[model samples]
Target: MSPATALRRNSDLGAALAEARAAYAAARPRSAAQHERAREVLPGGNTRSVLIYGPFPTAMTRGQDCRLWDLDGHAYLDLCGEYTAGLFGHSEPRIHRVLHATLEEGINLAAVGQGEERLARLLCGRFPSLAQVRFTNSGTEANLMALAAARAFTGRGTTMVMRGGYHGGVLTFPASGTNAATLPLPFVHAAYNDSDEAARLARAHAGDLAAVVVEPMLGSGGCIPAQPGFLAALRALADETGAVLIFDEVMTSRMSGGGMQARLGITPDMTTLGKYVGGGMSFGAFGGRADIMAQFDTTLPHAGTFNNNVLTMAAGGVAMGEIFTPEAAEALFQRGEALRARLNEIGRQAGVPLGFTGLGSMMTAHFRQPLPDRPYAASPAEEALRELFFFDMLAAGIYLARRGMVALSLPVGEPEMDRFVAAVGEFAESRAALLRAGGIAG
Candidate 1:
């Protein structure tokens, strides 16, 4: 297209986005009020950056089953699933019972609890990489400790992470420099799923590399699953270099009974976990071969006051042992696959630039013109579509991340999935003019 034509198209797209923003603000008067009130106490009216968006974020009142009610009295089918932490949904009966029982007994015993051991045992039996484990307050801590352990074991100072990876709050990767949160540790950022480049980096940093940390599937970085070959290559490189391979399964653990490591049949030296593993509580864990984890001896000292608290242990025990069993997880995975297939079909039928990337119950929609060769490296067009889709989906009563992430929980079923699909169809129809003008859809 010529410069004048391109300029006109850009101007039109900007106008449409402005209109959508206005519509969003007008629809959520109560949310806007709540955000204004929150801004007085909380910076930008948000504790989490991702939860904050333009015009203001909606203040959710309560959640039950698979639905969330916002301050505006707008109810939504929660496809974001609290970014995969709400795997058990808002109110899983088993989790509620376990938590209540634990609360009745005691919260912090101020010592090592038997419940921790029980949960640990269950985790060890399920995840082959976890021969022994240690608990933490959040996924960030789990990753921190895991990296520390790898460094201690290898006596090295450098760690390697993927380009678009996000291990935790501070462990963010190469974003637009808009966020300042990050680990101070020396990190060699490599491309996701590019085994050759990663292998080269690993070999180059061979002697000093302490750990090669990665997500089996990129969770916050657009829900892209690692190609099997890429994972296997990393495993081989770790073996060759004597570096500990740490799989950050904080989000991907919900993929199956044994998590993605099991499903992929590739094991890592150490694994970090969080999210629904705590049975909807604040939780994180790191574990690996017994020999490596054994270094957590008193001499080395890994300390956290609430690391082995009874509440998380009690709830987690029930979450893994009873609630999200292998059978249940398998069923959920199947349902997710079906939902994803249907969504892709709708996109194809509508001739939209919409696409999805993920595995099992986790997925993210992308507005790639012809879909991306890799999820991490997205075009500007894809990014713009993601922003537009977020607003459209929210208006349609489907709560998802602005990044287009949609995570499925056990409480969601066929009816909810159907409704979500229909909403996507409607959004496509309504936005056809804008989408076509921007070359985002037919």
Candidate 2:
């Protein structure tokens, strides 16, 4: 392409994106007004950073099944699934019944409840790595406690974490720079999916490295799956360095009944759980080899007022035991696998530079061909295209993350999947020229 032609194409792409944003803003006046109102009390009218996007986010009114109604009264097929926390979907009858029963029984019992033991037993039985477990209020707290246990057990202070890994709000390590909100810890960051680099870092800091934390699949960091041999390498490194390997399965736990660790046959020293494990309620858990977790019993102090709250415990027990059984987990994994393949096939047939990466009911769309192994490799042009795609999908009554993430819920079946695929096909056909010009085409 000539310089003049490239310039013209870029101009056209800008206009196209501008037109989409204008249409998005025009269609949802009420949402815009609500955002303005929220800005009075909330910073950027948002508490969660990931939900914020340009032209403002459409404030959701309610969700039923797999559908959500925005403040403007537009109904959408909810593909975001609350970032994998809504695996059971909105209005799961089993969970609701359990929650109602728990509420009727009473909340804030302020005592050790039988529900905690039931849930813990269920978790330990399902996941092989969990010889013993402790609960928390969220995944962040679960990871924090897990790291604390590692440090206490190993008698070391430094942690080795993967770059672009997100353990929690305060434990995030992006590919570049640092998150101001990140907890102040002695951390040595290594590239994701690069086992050699991880090994080197672990060996270099072996003496002080208490834990090597990693996500089986980078969740918020674009759903990039760990390549073959990557996790095994980390396992070996942890053994050699005497560092506790902590797998952050907060998001990827949905990959199987026992999580990615079980699915891949690589057990970590410690594992953290959250999201759907709470039956869509606030919950988190960290557990591992009894020997390491024994520190909590003796030296380490792990305490949270709501850690054993009856509601989460009751719902989680039912969620794992009754609702999302081992069979259901496997079925969802197959469903997601088929959906991802179909989406990629559509992109290929359309000759568009769009694809999805992820494993089993959790995936992220990217406006780039031959998707990179890490988030930092995504280009700014691709990001612009992703933003445009977000608007397009929203207009078509499909809801996903602005960052192109999709977490399929139990309520999302064949019909919803078909609609999503059709929407993607339409977007590819409509934006073929712009996508190609953005240099994302193969």
Candidate 3:
């Protein structure tokens, strides 16, 4: 069916969802059938539960450049890009050629490889704050090490982080600072974007705080950027309290030339990174001051067999070789502006409140009533509507973060960007129609 016809019929989500199911059928009927068969062995029929949603998900068969092809051979402009790790885009030539070369040599080794130093050199050079760096298998492990080093350095038991700040997973920093129970150390979480409260709480635990860790932009908390001066205030509090500061830039590192903190001109004592650092492979790292990082030596073993695998190093070297160049950053920012503009325009015409959080290539959609009503309402209706938005977008050939953020990657040039804009444009109309039909209610 034509998009206009689908839009006309989808006056409510009940209808829109049915139309969405039809759209999915047209795109990957086989994938949906396969997903049903796989669900028996896999919880929710997926290795990653987040990938599962109503009407099922299309299994992507291949990705190259800025496009993804499903099992049924339907093409889509890949805006999600494996949750932002495909920053250089799928099968980037440099990374592809290098990984293939490395695989000929080996994949993982018990001992480190020369490529480890190559990737490390690029990281330290990119961020001047990093005097020493330690590799890990994922961002979750990186944050765990960051926290451990902070505690050891300060000899303090507690730390401060923002509420709704997502770091990584259980072995490290699972959930966010918002979920108080999961914090490994004595963590104090204050509402995000409120510098006054952060300062107050950090100071309250001043004598005991080892660090104040936060995301420069809250990635999972509805894509809300921290309010202006918020980060600076945390920095000051950390200094006054003698607490180490950490910037969990695993997601936000794609923003600036140096990282989000560099672009914002606010420096944290340490930073955690992963996701895209290994080209398209799994890799993670935490690095900071020479004195603090020395603890990672014999004093506290930062040793892990898989910390710096060989293949990831090769792919990462290629990724960094491309990323560290001025051209790569410029391409990211320029593309970012275009995507943001298109989304804003589409949402505006549809009478939807639309804006983005994060800088440069990492733009996440912000939809809801304007300020004074609270950016993220915890009401039941608001919660369900937010979840519903995600499923709707996916069915329309657009994937979104479980929290409704969208990360743009390198492969998305003009053609892919136009396709994405078209999807969002359809999303705007579909959402507006849903609201008018009482499928959604404030």
Question: Which candidate gets the maximum TM-score versus the true structure?
Answer: 2
Highest-scoring model, lDDT: 2
The residue pairs that clash in candidate 1, if any, are none
Candidate 2 Cα deviation (angstroms), residue 220? 0.8
Which scores better on lDDT, 1 or 3?
1
State the displacement of the C-alpha of residue 276, model 1, in Å, after optimal TM-score superposition: 0.3
How good is model 2 by TM-score? Answer: 0.96
Candidate 3 lDDT by residue in tens digits, 134-209: 8999888899899999998999989776656677755223333234336556777677778878888987888899
Candidate 1 local lDDT, 226-267, one digit each (tens): 889999999999999999999999998888889999999999
lDDT of each: 0.86, 0.91, 0.73
Pick by TM-score: 1 or 3, better one: 1
Model 2 stretches astray by more than 4 angstroms: 1-11
Sequence-dependent TM-score of model 1: 0.94
C-alpha displacement of 229 in model 1, angstroms?
0.4
Model 2, range 1-442, lDDT digits (tens) per residue?
Answer: 5776545434577877887899899999998998999899999898998878878989998999999999899999999999999999899999999999889999999999899999999999998799999999999999999998999898999999888899999999988889999999899999999878887888999989999999999998999999759999999999999999999999999889899999999999999999999999999999999999888878889889999999999999999989998899999999999999999998899887789999989999888778767757567788788888899999999999888999999999999999999999988877788888774655
Q: Choose 2 or 3, whichever is better by TM-score.
A: 2
TM-score of each: 0.94, 0.96, 0.88
